[model samples]
Target chain A: MSESFQRSAGRKVMSRSSAKELGAVSHLLVDAQQRQIAAVVIGRGKKAQLVEWAQLSGFGPDAVMVVDEGALQPPADDRERAAAEGRLELVGKRALSERGNELGKLDDVTFDADTGALEDLLIGDRRVHAGSLLGSGSYAAVLDESQEPSP
Target chain B: MRLLMTASQIRGLPVVTVQGGEDVAEVRDVIYSPEAGRLVGVTLNKRGFLAGRSREVLPAEAIHAVGQHAVMVLDESSLAAPEDAPDDVAHPAMERNVLGDDVLTEGGASLGKVADLVLLVGSSGEVVGYQIDKAGGGRGYIPLPAQLSVSGVALVVPNITEEFVQDDLVGLGAAVDEFRARLGLP
Candidate 1:
C-alpha cells in the first residue's frame, strides 16, 4: 500500500528492543534520482536524528518500528543534514516544469510503504507520476514538462 | 499559437535552475541588443521574500527557456559575475533604448512610438514584435521586421507594416507569423 509523506510526518518512532519512543517524524529525505524515500528525519536542526529506510523493520499506522536506539543516528552527510534542517523537504516547495512553467506547490507525495519507492506527487488537484520528477532543491521541484497531469 | 509577452512584464521573474529547480535570482533588467534584435542577458537581483540586487547576471546563451512564470537555466553555474558578463550587459548603451523611438514607414508616415517589446514565450529570449503607443490613439502591436533601420530617434519599417498593426497581444501573436510569411522571413 502507498503512504503519504504528509500523513507520515509527526508519527512516532519506537525501538523494538527497548520498546521506547525515540522521536517523531519531522520529514522525509528523498532520493530524487531513485524516486524513493532515503530516510525519515526525527526532530530538526541540531536535535535532528535520522532513521535510514534500511533500519526500519516496520512502518505502521501508529508508529515506525526500528531495531533499537542504535538505528537512530545523526545526519550522515551534507545532504542528510540539509534534509534534517527541512531545507530539502518536498512538501510546500513550488513545482516547476522542466520548461520553467509553475505547476503549483507540491501538496503531498505518495510512496510504497514497503519499498519506499515513490508513486505520485500531488500538485493542487493534479497527480503527477513519480517517474516525471527530475530533481528538487531549496527553491522548487523540477518535473518533466511533458508529464504535466491533465486538469 | 505561440504565447507573447512584453519585456516589461518579464521583469521580476525568478531565474530558476532546472537541475535542482533553485531560484538563484530575480530579473532586475532585461538587457536587449537593439542592433542584433535579441536579448543578450539580464541583470539579476537576489531572490527571496526581501528584495535586494545580486551581483550575478545570466547571459541569453545560458538560458534554456523564458516561460511565463520563470526564466530557466541548466544550473547555478550558468550565472556569471558582472565582469564576466558581455559588455552590453555590464554597461548598457543609453542610445540602444528602443522605447520612445518613433516608428516610421519607408514612405515617412508615422505609425507610433515604441512602448514595449513583445517576446515569444518558451523561447530563449526571442523578441517577436513591438508594442506601440499609436500616433492616433490607444496601443497597437507590430511584428518585428527581418531587418531594422533603427536610429536613436526613429525606426524605419516597410510601408506594408501599417496593414499589420494588431490591437492586442493575442492579435499580435497571429499577426507575427502572417507578417513574417508576407515578408518571406523564415
Candidate 2:
C-alpha cells in the first residue's frame, strides 16, 4: 500500500527490543535520482535523529519499528544534517520546472509502505511522477517539465 | 511558457546550494557581457543578518540553474575569490554599462533609451531582448536585433526592429523567435 507523507508525520517510532518510543517522525529524506526514501528524520533541529531505511524493521500504519534504540543515529553529514533540521523537507517547497518556471508548492509525497520507494509528488492538485524529480534545495525543488520537451 | 526577467531583478536573489539546501550568498550585481549577449558572472553579498558585499564571485559556469526564486549552485565551493574569478567578473565594477544609451535604428530613427535587459530563463543566462523607455510613450521590449554598432551615445539596430517592439516580456518572448527567424539568426 502507498502511504502519504501527511499520514506519516508525527507517527511514533518504537524500538523492537524494548518497545519504547524513540521519537516521532519528522520527515523522510529522499534520494531524488533513486526515487526512494534515504532515511527518516525524527525530532528537529540540533536534537534531531535519523534512522536509515535499511535499519527499520517495519513501517506500520501505527508506528515505525526499529531493531533497537541503537538504530537511531545523529546526522552523518551536512546534507543529512540539513534534512534533520527540516531545511530540506520535500513537502511545502516551491516546485520549479527544469526550465525555471514555478509550477506550485509541493503539498505531499506518496511512497510505498513496504519498500520506501517514492511514487509521486503532489503539487497542489497535480500529481507529478517520482521520475521527474531532478534536484531540491532550500529555495525550491527542481522537476523535469515532462509535458513539453524542447526540441 | 518561457519565463522572462530583467537583469536588474536578479540582483538580491539568494544563491542556494543543492546538496545541503543552504543559502550561501545573495547576488550583488550581474556581470553581463553585452557584446556577447550573455551573463558572465555575478558578485555576491553575504546572506542573513548584518550581511554585506561578499568578496567571492560566482562565474556563470558554476551556476546549476537560475530560477525565479534562487540561483542554484553545486556547493558553496562554487564561489571563488575576486582574484580567482574570470576577467570580466574580477573587474566588473568599471565595465561599460549599457543602460541609458540611446536606441536607434539603422535608418537613424530614434526609438528610445535603454532601460534594462530581458533574459530568457533556463537558457543559461542568454540575453534575448532589451527593455526600453520608448521615445513617444511608455516602456517597451524589443527582441535583441543584430547590432550594427554600440557607441557610448547610441546602439544602432536593424531598421526592421521597429516592427517588433513588444509591450511586455511575455510578448517579447514570443516575438524573439519570429524576429530571429526574420534576421536569419540561428
Candidate 3:
C-alpha cells in the first residue's frame, strides 16, 4: 500500500500556479490501503472538481498546489448531472419526528477526522446525536426539551 | 469528561417560535451516524400537518440558534412542508432509484432507471462520482454532478418530472452487477 498520499482531513489545497488562490479539499482519493493520494477532488467554484495529484505542483501547512486549471474538465455528462441532482435533493428533505413533524432540511454532514466515517448529520437548528446509532450494532436515542436539564 | 449532550438530546426539543410563544413543531427524529458522530439531519413534526406529512430535514448549519425551547432556522422558506417533496426528502434513491425506473428524455420519453451509480470514492471513501444506472443493463457509470442535493432520501435532480417511480426509494448506490458480487448493494 502506498503511504505518501495519506492526508489529514480538512487539509486545504493551494494553487501552485496562482499563489493566493486556494480551495477547500473535501476528500482525497487514495489507494485501497488508505494511503497514497491518487487524485484529489477539490470543492471549488460551484462544484467539486477532480484533479490528478500530478497536477499538484506544491504543498504547505495551510494549502496545496495545482497546475492552474490543468486538471479542470468541461461540465457536461448525464451521470455527473444526475449526481449533482442527488446533491440538490438533499437540501429539501424533511427532518421529521418519530411522530413525523416538520423540522428542517439537512444542512451538512460531518465526518470523523481520523477514520473518515460519518460522524453526525447537522440538522437545521439542532444537532441530533447519531454516534451510538451508526456502525455495527448501536442504536440512537431521541431527546427533547423535556429530557434536557434546565440550563 | 465534561458532560457532553448527545445529538438526540438536541433533536428531541420542541421548536418554539423565536419571536414569541407559538410552538412551531416537535422534534420527531434525528438522523445521524456513528462514523463521524456529528449531527447531520433532524426530523421535525409540524403541528398542523397530518402525521408523516409535516416532517422536514434541514442542514445543521441552517440552525441559527439552539435555545432551551426552540431551534431557530436560518431560512424560513426551507421550512415550508410541501405534500410532494422531491426524492431526497422522501427516500434515498441510492443505486436502486436510478437503475430501471426509466430515465425520461427532455421531451418525456422512457430512457431507463439507473442500472448503476459510478461514484468517485477518494482515498478517504468520500463519494465523488455518481454514475447513473442506464438501460440495456451495462455498467455505464457517470460522475455525480456537483449541483445535486444529497440529503435524506432521494437524489434531487431539478427540472426532472415526477412520473418516474411507482414507489418511494430506500437508498442509492451503484448497480448490483458492478460490485465484485460479495459486497452486495449498500
Candidate 4:
C-alpha cells in the first residue's frame, strides 16, 4: 500500500472507537523510541482523566482502541493535566533575539501543517537590540506590543 | 520519501559558472526556516570570519540558481555587509524567562547574555528539549522533564545536574544521541 494510505488507515482505526465511552482523546502522545503512536490522553467529563497508552489494545486511524478507561489511573487534576500534556507540543520553539540578546518569549509559532516545517515565531512585546551609540550603552531597545499576554 | 533536494546538495555547488560579478566572496552559510523547511537567506563569507563581523541578509529572490558548484546571486552589488552588529554572546543567556531580567549561572558568573531560547523537536516533530543560549558563545540543551514551570522570566530546571553537560551535550546531534542513550534506544 502507499504510505499515505497506510497513514489514513491507521487514523481510521483509531477514530472508530467511541471517544466519550472509552474517554475523550485530547491528543496522541507519541513514543519517540518506537517511532509509533504511544498513548492517548482521555478526559472524563470535567473532573477526572487518564492517560491510556499502556492499556491500549489497538489504535485506529482517528482514535485509539482501548479496553477500559476505569482500569487506568487518573491523573491528579483533569484540566491541569490536560493543559500540561498539551504544552508538550511546544518543544523546540525558537526563542527570539533582540539587541544581540534574547529579550522575550516567542508567544506563538506557525508552521506548514502538511510538511511539519516551521514558518515564523511570534516574538511579542520584547526589547530588541537596534545598534550602538557612543559611550552610553551601544544598544537601543525597542518593544513590540503584539507580544502582550493573552486575556 | 525523497522529493526535495538536501541542504548539502545546495552547499556543494561550485561558485564559478553561476554568473554575477567578480569573485566578491564565497557562500558561507545558508539560513533555513526550520518551520517551512525552506531556504530563506544565504550568508556570504566575503571576508572569512570577518563575514560575521560585516554580514549581509540576502532575500530568497536574490538567489539566481542552485547549480552544481555555486549559488548564483541576482546582483553582486546588492550584497551589502551588516554593520553595528552585537558582540558574540554565549548560548545559556537566551533561556531567561520573558519577563525576568538576565540570569546568572548557579555560580553567579555572568555567562554572556541571553539572546533566545530554542525548543528542540524530535524526528517525529515532538518537542523533546529546550536549549538555552549565552548570546553567540555556546548553547546548552536542557531536556524537557515530565513537568515544567515557567513564571515571570525565570525557568527552573528539575533534576538537571552539571553531569548532563559532561555527557557531550553540545549541538542537536549530541543532544539526540544523549537522549537516545538515556532511553536505552539501540
Candidate 5:
C-alpha cells in the first residue's frame, strides 16, 4: 500500500539498515478491509518470509525498501500461509448477492497501484466496487444489495 | 474479473502442448505446498481407459496458462517421469490427504470438514486457505497457519477462530486476510 506499487511480484527486496539483500517478492498479501498490500510473501516453502508494508521504508522502481533484514520472518505460521493461498483465489470463484443469487464468474478486480486500494470487481458483465466487497471467502464474493457503491 | 479455477474445476484438465496442442497428459492432482503458499507442481495420469496411478509431472514453471478447459504448456519439454522431475516437481510426502479430515477447536468443538484447498490467483506455488464444512452445517474457510495443531486425526484451531468462518468465497477470502492480521501470522 506504500504509494501504490503497481508491479510487486518478483521485485528484489533489500534491507535499508543492514544493506543486505533478502530476496525477491513472491506474493503480495493484500488486506481486504484496508484494500491494500499488507505484506509481501517472499522466499519459498520452509524459507518463505513475510515483510509487512509498515516495515517497508519505500517502494522504488528497482527494489522494495525495508527497515532491516530482521524485518523478514518466515511465513511458516499456518494462518499467514493460509492467506497466501486465498489471495489470488478470488478470480475463479463465483459472485453471489445476499439473496443467494448467482451472479457470475468473478472475472477480474482492479487495485490501485498508488494507494493499494482494491478498486472494482468485474463479475461477468457487471462491476462491483470495493465498497460492495462483502466477503471474499472460499465459496464466493458475496455482495450486499442493501449497500451498493455509488457510481 | 480475474478468473479463478478451483482444484476440482481444473482437475481432468488436459495438459496440452503449446506447439502441437498434443494432449501430452491430463492433470490428475494439483500439488500445493501450504508452507510455500503456491502451487509446487502437478501429477498426471496417462491418457488411458483405465484409472491408474499418477506418474508424469510438470513443475509449475512449465505451465503457460490454465484456460477454461485446458492447461497449456510451452512445450512437451516439461513432461517428464516423476523420478526425473526436479526436486520441486516431485510430490512431497503426503502420508495423508487432509482433504476430508475434520477440523476442530483446540478444546474439541467441531469446526468443520476440509472441503477444498484454495489456491490464490497469480501465486505460482503457494496455498492460501482451507474451505471447511462448518459444524454449523455450512462452509467456511480459515486462513493458513491459523495456529492449528495437528493431532494425527484432526486439525485443532483456536476457539476464537469460530468468528472467522465464512459462507462464501469472497467472505472466506476476506476472512483469511483479517485472520492473518489478527494473528499477525508473519
Candidate 6:
C-alpha cells in the first residue's frame, strides 16, 4: 500500500543494536530516476544523517527498524545530485502533458515505505499511478497525454 | 466507502464530548496519517479567536463521528497533549501549510501562491490539488502528483500551470472531478 511522505515524516528510527530510538525521520531523499528512496534523512538540520535504503529493515507503525545506526552517514553528494539532476523534487512541481495540456501541480506522492517504490501521484487532487509519468525535472513533471485530466 | 469533505468545511466544526455533550474545542486542523491511510486526529483551537494554541491533539480513534454540524468525540480526556517524548517525535512544525506557498514551474515561471488545499477524502486523507490563487487575478487548482517537491521558499509545480487557471471555486471543483475521472478512481 502507498503512504504519504507527510505521514512518514517524524516516525522514529530505531537502532536494533541498542534497541533504542535514535531519532525521527526528517525527510526522504528519493531517486527520481530510480523511483525509490535512495536514503532516509533523519533528525535535525546539519546534525541530520542519511540511512541508505539498503540498510533499513522495516518500517513499523511506530518505528523505522535498522540493524545498525552506523549504516547512516552524514549526507554526501545530496547537493551535487540536486545540482546535477536540476533538483527533481516531486512534492510541489507542476505537471503537464507534452502535447500541451495543462494538467495540474503535484501535491503529494504515495509510495510504499517498505519497498521504497513510488505508487501513485496525487496530482490535481486526484490519484494517478506512477505509470503516467513521462518525464520530470525541477521545473515540471510531464505526463502521458492519456493521463491528462479533463471533463 | 469514500467520504467528501473540505478542510474549510470542517475547520470550525464544534468538537463535543460524547459522554456529557460538553463542548471542548473547535476543529482547527485535521491531522491525517498517510501510513494508516486515514484521518487520525484534529488539532483544536481555543474557544476564542485570540486564544493561545492548544497542544492537545484529538486522536481519530477517539472521534465518535464526523457529523454535518459538529465533530463528535468519544472522550474529551482522550484529547491529550501530543506526545513530545524524544523517541516518538511527531513534530508540530512538520505540519504543512500549502496555503500562501509559492507555485512555480521547473522552468521558474510563477503561477501564484496557494489559496487552499483540495483534499481527496478516503479512508486516508490526501492533499490532492493546490488551489492556486493567481497573481493575475484568476484562480486554478494544480493536481497533486507523485513527482513534486516542496522547500522552505516555494512549491514547485510542473511547468505551464498558469495556463490551467479556472475562474472560481466551482470551476476548480469541476476541474478536480475531471482529474479524478481521468484516473478512473472514485
Candidate number with greatest DockQ: 1
- Roughly what TM-score does model 6 have, to 2 decimal places? 0.40
Kindly list the per-residue Cα lDDT of model 1 for residues B35-117, writing each as its tens digit: 77779888899977767988888889998888778898988899998798888888888898899999999999999999998
Q: Residue by residue across A41-151, what tens digits does model 5's lDDT show?
A: 776566677888788887676887789988887665554675455443455566654323345777766665445577777776776776776554444555554432221
Error of 6 at A55 (Å): 68
- For TM-score, candidate 3 versus 6, the one ahead is 6
lDDT score for candidate 6 against the true structure: 0.62
* Model 5: per-residue Cα lDDT over B101-150, one tens digit each: 78887677888888887655433434556788777787676666533455
What are the per-residue Cα lDDT tens digits for candidate 6 across B49-139?
A: 6565677777666666564345655445757677732212234335344567788887988888877655543212355566677767676
Deviating ranges (above 4 Å) for candidate 5 = A1-151, B1-5, B16-23, B32-39, B46-54, B61-72, B86-94, B106-108, B146-151, B158-160
* lDDT at position A131, candidate 4: 19
User: Which runs in model 1 stand beyond 4 Å of their true positions?
Assistant: A75-82, A147-151
> Candidate 4 — which residues are off by over 4 angstroms?
A1-20, A31-38, A44-48, A76-85, A90-151, B1-186
Q: Cα deviation in Å at residue A12, candidate 6?
A: 64
For each candidate, how many residue pairs have backbone atoms clashing (under 3 Å)?
0, 0, 113, 49, 50, 30
Tell me how each candidate scores on DockQ against the true complex: 0.57, 0.41, 0.01, 0.01, 0.01, 0.01
Residues B1-186 of candidate 3 have per-residue lDDT tens digits of 011222334555654432222245656654332122222334677654454435565444444444423454422444534244433434433443323434444454533454432221111112222334444544333323233443332344322322222111111233222331332323
CAPRI accuracy category, model 4? incorrect
Residue A21 local lDDT, model 6:
85
| Candidate 3 TM-score to native | 0.24
Candidate 1 total steric clashes: 0
Residue A91 in candidate 3 has what lDDT?
24
Per-residue lDDT for A1-151 in model 1, tens only? 7799999999999999999999999999888878988899999999999989999988888999988899899988887888888999999999988776788999999999989999999999889899999888888898887854332
Per-candidate local distance difference test: 0.87, 0.83, 0.38, 0.35, 0.63, 0.62
Q: Per-residue lDDT tens digits of candidate 6, residues A41-95? A: 7764567677888898886677888888788777577442442232445667666
